[model samples]
Target: MAVFSLMLVVFSLTTGEFVVSGILPDLAAGLGVPLSAAGLLTTAYAAGMIVGGPVVTLLTARVSRKPLIIGLVATSVLANAASAIAPGYAVLLVSRMLAGLVVATFFAVAIATAASTARPGKQASTVGKVVLGLNLGIVLGAPLGTFVGQHLGWRATFWSVAAAAALALLTVLRFVPDRPSATTGPVAGELRVFADRRVQLAIALTAVGNTGVLTVFTYLAPLLTEVGGFPPGAVPVLLLGYGAGAVLGNAVGGRLADRALLPSLAGLLATLVVVLGLAWLGGGHPVATVVSTVLLGALAFAIVPGMQTRVITAAGAAPTLAVAVNASGYQLAAAFAGWLGGQVVDSGAGLRAIYPVAAALTVAGLGIALYSLRRDRRESSAQGSLPGGRSRTS
Candidate 1:
């Protein structure tokens, strides 16, 4: 019940975050802005997350996890309500930014809480359950919200999110316990976890790797309609396929990561490179494009559990702050990728070019993963050897 409650909180948060993707056209048309300008909504939301994750984590370091979760959900409800009733583009952007801030804090705290609740050695699996909420939001919530937005109005979508969040808040308040953090250190002490080389590498890998996925995902609607020759109405269906793949990938990746973290990370990044490469080549054909979208979603999300587990383990005593920083890294990468994709579209390079760019980013991330893996093995070998060249444990 507790786990389910946490999932609902994450679901509501993620739906609010991603629902904009499906309704960008509606939002643009309603506001009388260009697509590029509407794209700024994504950028603004990510920028708020990038800035808010660490800041909120620092400020709330001493707060109990349960109340903090409740408060964040309440904030989300208000933000979405504001979004639903915003008078103009500027007002809507402000609402998104506020929502982003609360959502980032919610994820960092909620993931930490979920992981801490796990039985020994099953941390990734527990965390993955929470992440499943995120995938489910992508799978069920976003498309449903998109459908509502299309039929009613985009503002109606935010209203739906606000109501969902309100329900999640009640569930969380009732079911989830107040789990105190293991690290009771001051904010400065918690921040010091960034000094670890492994944690640092994990953050970089997360940012670079996630940028690959977001680069393509941020522009998927336009690519499908304009380049793949799909009707605009088909976008939700395609996203549903993509989201289903993400659900499978998230489950598999979490279990695999629990068994072999580094190998799982490297393998998933390699898969992303291949999937995006295929997407780049096959995006112009209808069937191929749909298949590639599903594959891309799966391969891209498969890296998340491993990467997140790596950061939590590497950070040792300061997992909360570490996870918050990692979330910030993802949003920073997403913000940059969103902006870059917009520029690519505006440059008249066409929608097909975005997939190749995404592939390149994944390749870069794969290189980092390999480098981190090698470093880990070398360190492990060094720790195992004794002063006289004997096995330390034996």
Candidate 2:
């Protein structure tokens, strides 16, 4: 029940993050902005996450988990409400950013809480379930919010998100146990974990590795309807398929990461590159495009649990702050993706161009993962060696 409530909290908070994707056209029109310009709303929210995660986590390092989470969700409710009532684009943009500010702290706490409850050796699976809330927000909340936006208005979507967040807040208060952090200490102490080359690599790997997926996903609506020739009404249904794929991917990825973390990421990233290319090639065909959509969600999200585990392990004693910083890095990359994708759309390369470029970014991420794996092996080899150049415990 605690984990489930935490998932519900994630659902409400994250719905605000991607709801703009589903209702981009409507929102752009409603706010009297260019479609391209409206894409920045996504960027704005991401930018907030980019700034909020590390900064807020550092500040609240000593706060109890349950209260911190409740406060964060309450902030989300207010931010979404502010978005719903914004008088114009600037106001709405600020509101979105504000809503984003609470995400990383909330997520870090939720993840720690969920992990604390996990049975030994099931960390990845349990983390996957926590991440499932994020998947649910992406797959279910965004589409339903979009459906609501289509029927009522874009503002109505924000209003509805606010209500959902409020309800989740109650569940969080009821169910999320106050699992105190063990490493709660001075900020200066926690900062040293970033000095580890592997830790730095893990954080960069997340930002660089995930950029491609975010790029394609940020522009999915236009790619589906404008390029693939699907009607606007078909989007919500297609998103459901994408959502289904995401859920499956999360489950499978968790199990794989539990068995072998780096190897699993390598496979998933390679598959992601191919799937992204397929999305590009299949852009013009409705059937193929739909297939790519589901595969995209699956491949894109399949890597998350492993990535999270990688950084947390790397950060060691400062896992909470590491998770927050990692999430911020992810949003920083996402903000770049939204900008780069928009540039692709405007550069005469068209929306299809975004996919190929996205594939390239994923390739870079794969390279990073390989390097990190190689380094891990080298360090393990060194540590296992004795002063006399012989094996230790074997």
In angstroms, how far off is 266's CA in candidate 2? 0.6
List the candidate 2 regions with Cα displacement exceeding 4 Å.
21-41, 85-93, 150-155, 225-232, 281-286, 387-394
- TM-scores for all candidates: the values are 0.90, 0.89
Query: Going through the candidates in order, what is the number of backbone clashes in each?
Result: 0, 0
CA lDDT for candidate 2: 0.87
The candidate that wins on TM-score is 1
lDDT of each: 0.86, 0.87
What's the CA error at residue 211 for candidate 1, in Å? Answer: 1.6
Most accurate candidate by lDDT = 2
Question: Model 1 off-target regions past 4 Å?
Answer: 21-40, 85-91, 151-155, 343-349, 387-394
Q: Per-residue CA lDDT of candidate 2, range 3-109, in tens? A: 88888888988888878977999989998999988998987888888889988888888788888888899999999999999999999988999998889988877
lDDT of 2 at 185: 63
Local error of candidate 1 at 267, Å?
A: 0.9
Q: Write the per-residue lDDT of candidate 1 for residues 239-353, one digit (tens) a residue.
A: 8898888988888888989898888888888888887878777778899999988887787777888888888889888887888889988878877887899888889988888
Error of 1 at 158 (Å): 2.4
